[model samples]
Target: MGKLTRILSTAALSAAIASVSLTAAADGTTNWRMATPWSGGPWLERDAQSFATHVRELSNGSINIEVFPGGTLGSALKVTDSVKSGVAQVSHNYINYDYGKDQTTALLAGHSSGLTPEEFMLWMYKGGGAELYEQYRLDKFGVVAFPCSILGTEIFLHSNKPVRTLEDFKGLRLRTSGAWAEIASRLGASTVVLAGSEIYSALERGVIDAAEWGSPEMNRPTGFQDVAKYVVLPGIHQSGGVLECQINKKVWDGLNPQQQTVLRDAAKLSVFDSWLSSSYADLKAYEELKNGKNEIVRLDPSFIKAVYEETTKWEDEYAGKNEWFKRVLDSQRTFKKDMQSWPEYRLQIGVSEL
Candidate 1:
């Protein structure tokens, strides 16, 4: 064959190889279903939706996630089970809701031991808390998890009657769950566990005297302000809330390295975005509540101190009972202790508080 004919044949072979490579890469595309523990319309649900959007965009549409807002697949509290059973490839929910399965779950979600939102984030990302959490999920549920959302301090409680001191808690029927419920019970308040959707009606019908949910932005959408005019502050039980995104282990393993990196970074971005958006919304909600008939009251300092003491005692007792709980608590305690000194030094150096 002549030189020109040989060159033409080589070019045609190169084109065919390129087409095959493109097809192989395109075949890696995936579509996943993600379920959240919150119903449609709340800031939390919006955060979950935003996370899905970020993942898709970051993956350049090679991976698409369809988010199912609260209870669409099943009860919100059972989201972990849904992901574990492969009913859903992913889920966004507070891990503390599953504290019944293992007390350590509360440490990842929200614990009353007094870590602020920033502190929790620091511990999770830098202080080795994230690794423990990931291991716990894999060992217990056969799933992979990430901290996808972080909430500012929650409102302590919303009440029909004013709560002035520890005495006021006597005979008060409260709707809450996890360690907070235990603390409330010790304080003489009868505690009941109610789903998020049930809180408004329960308060309106006088089924419960008080309840604590999310931040002002989250609670406003539930219309808690309308049902309970007296809003308490300084959420002592839950200083902050963390939402986790869990994926089925098989699904997570199927992802390529780049896809895994996108998922991880997308989750971190969601955590930051949710924190900022919720903080702004809470400020606005606070202003609106002030203008309305609602009265926002801060819990008395002495009462808060008492609650903190109780929380410490409860933490000791519970940690002694569960090995995993002890492991997480020890890790957080060490991180908190090490970081606590810096803030003191900063204050001494005259840095103004924010």
Candidate 2:
């Protein structure tokens, strides 16, 4: 689509998502409070609000969800905890936040940029990833999960210095999280851990040489470009991942069959809808940066190849230590291999063969 068309579509979707219809409570209505890690405006928050709206409509107002942006209900760090403790019946968040308890959670978020969006989507729906995700969440944290939002590829490095090559990353301090943090460390960069609010200042004060955040649209307003003039491409850290709707197990157990189905369907719908909108918006955001003061740096192909090799070694060691990691890793790798069949066949034949 053209830029103007995409812009208009994004604006319309934003406006529609801003206002969600909810009827007055009646008998049989199940009230839920959903806490999210985003304060407001970002598509992540919109994803949560959109899911709640869908649940209300699909359940015919039998389910009413109130979405609390970050810090309103609890700190971003405690979103999952809030849901588990019943302070909120549900939370919208990245599963990687629970990595302290289960390393497997990191794989679900982004395993070293392991799966591209195309492969990830196929694995999620057709390759049993949903079931594995649900099982892991319930086992690791007393909650049920449905992937409520899917992130597009993010910016790899927003830095004051050029980080286009593997050599440049050596001894460079960076701010990042999840599995990529460890991978970055092994790659000879000193990876720093910082909160979302601290990234800009960390870059401004020269505390971190670079940082990786979400998609372009999400990072634009954070003002990273003002502090760091280099915008790196192919966010190898998080090519894609899901933000989940994690429900309290007790509350989930109380849900009737139809209510449960409504929640699941709503999450699925929101994921698909958000992917389309986020992708278009992100592409538009990337295009706008073409003439900006920030210098765009593409990661060297060799750097990308090295990361793939390192990720496999790191994952293998973890798999040996953790069964869940092995299981999920196996599922993803198998699906990725299975997905290659079509491309391989197509390469061996001409279009005329069809």
| TM-scores, all models, native as reference | 0.87, 0.88
Per-residue C-alpha lDDT of model 2 across residues 1-354, encoded as one tens digit per residue: 699999999798656543332223458676777888887765545788888899999999878888888887667877888888776778889888888877898778876645766556677888999889999888878899978888788898899899878899899999988788888899999988999899999999998889988889899889998999899988887888877899889878877898889889998898888888888888778887767888999999999999888888889999999999999999988887887666755454225554
Cα RMSD for predicted model 2: 10.3
Candidate 1 lDDT over 11-35, as tens digits, reads 9865653344213244676667787
The reply for model 2, stretches above 4 Å from the true place, is 1-24, 342-354
Number of the predicted model whose lDDT against the real structure is largest: 2
Give the runs in model 1 whose Cα sits over 4 Å from its true position: 1-28, 43-45, 345-354
Residue pairs with colliding backbones in model 2 are none
Question: Model 2 has how many clashing residue pairs?
Answer: 0
lDDT for model 1 comes to 0.81
